[model samples]
Each structure stands twice: as structure tokens, then as C-alpha cells.
Target: MQAYDAQTLVLCALADGPLHGYAVNTAIERLVGTRLGPGSLYGALSRLEAKQLIEPADDAGAQPRQRPVRLTPTGRQVLERELRSMAKVAAAGLASLKVNPA
Candidate 1:
């Protein structure tokens, strides 16, 4: 997947709740039937954090590498908007091919 796609997947994975790095990858795999490479995963996480879309969760006793990350309010809003836009595109594409969504 493209870099932006990876970032979006990361956001979606975190939508339900905070998840540590490995959990996020697992969640994404469950959603999309494929796993991201370590580089793609960490790169997306770093980009999202840099953009203030995600933040490390407060698990006081957890190691830094094991700490989970949660979506910020802005991140949730962004994800919703992005999903809506994608849905519209998908609908249009499906209609063009006369294929009904499952």
C-alpha cells in the first residue's frame, strides 16, 4: 500500500481503541487480509504522531515500545471524513461496473 494508505489503515486500526504496535498490525491484517511490513507500520505511526493524529496512551507501567496509541479527537474526525469519501468513491466505481456492493 502507499504511505498515505498505510497511515489511514493505522488510524482505522486505532478507531475502536488504543493498540500497541503489534496489535495495530494484527488489527489491520484482520481488516484487510494482509499485514504491513515493520517499516510501513512504524513509519505510519511516526507520521501520524508527528501530525498529532495519534498519541501514545498512558500505560504507566508499560515499556515505551509496548505502550499503546490512541486516536486524538481530530484523528477520529479525520478518519470518519476519509472513510466517507472512500465510500463515495467506491459506490461510484461499483455503479460504473454495475456491481452491487456486498
Candidate 2:
């Protein structure tokens, strides 16, 4: 997947709650039918953290090596906006092709 797509997937993965690296990728895999590689996953996490879109969760019971993360409020807003934008694009593309979605 493209860089932005990976980042967006990361954001979507954290939408419901916090997750560590592995769980995040597992969720993504369930959604997309493929898991991201280590570099892609961690890189997207790092980028999202840098952008203040995601942050370490307050999971006191989490393992020392596993840092769970959740989306910030801004992240939620961004995700909603992105999803809407993608929906619009998809609708336009399908309409242009005269294809009715099931």
C-alpha cells in the first residue's frame, strides 16, 4: 500500500480503542486482508505520533515491550473527514462508470 494509505489504516485501526503494534497490524489485516510489514507499520505509527494523531495509551496492564496507542480527538476528526472524502471519490468514480454498487 501507499504511504498515506498505511497511515490512514493505522488511524482506522485505533479508532475503536488502543492497540499495540501487533494488534494494530492484526486489525488492519482483518480489514484489508493483508498485514503491513514491520517497517511500514512502525513507520506509520511513528509518523502518526509525530503528527499528534495518535498517542501512547494509559494501559497500566500493558506489557513493558508493548506500547498501546489510541487516536487523539484530532485523529478522529481527520479520520471522519478522510472517510467522507474517499466515499465521495468512490461515488463519483462509480457514477462515471455507470456502475451501481450492490
Worst 10 residues of 2 by lDDT: 58-67
Backbone clashes under 3 angstroms, per model: 0, 0
Top TM-score model? 1
Residue 15 lDDT, candidate 1, scale 0-100:
99
Quantify all predictions' global Cα lDDT against the true fold: 0.92, 0.89
- 39-59: candidate 1 lDDT, tens digit per residue: 999999999999999998988
**Which has the greatest lDDT?**
1
RMSD (Cα, Å) of model 1: 2.1
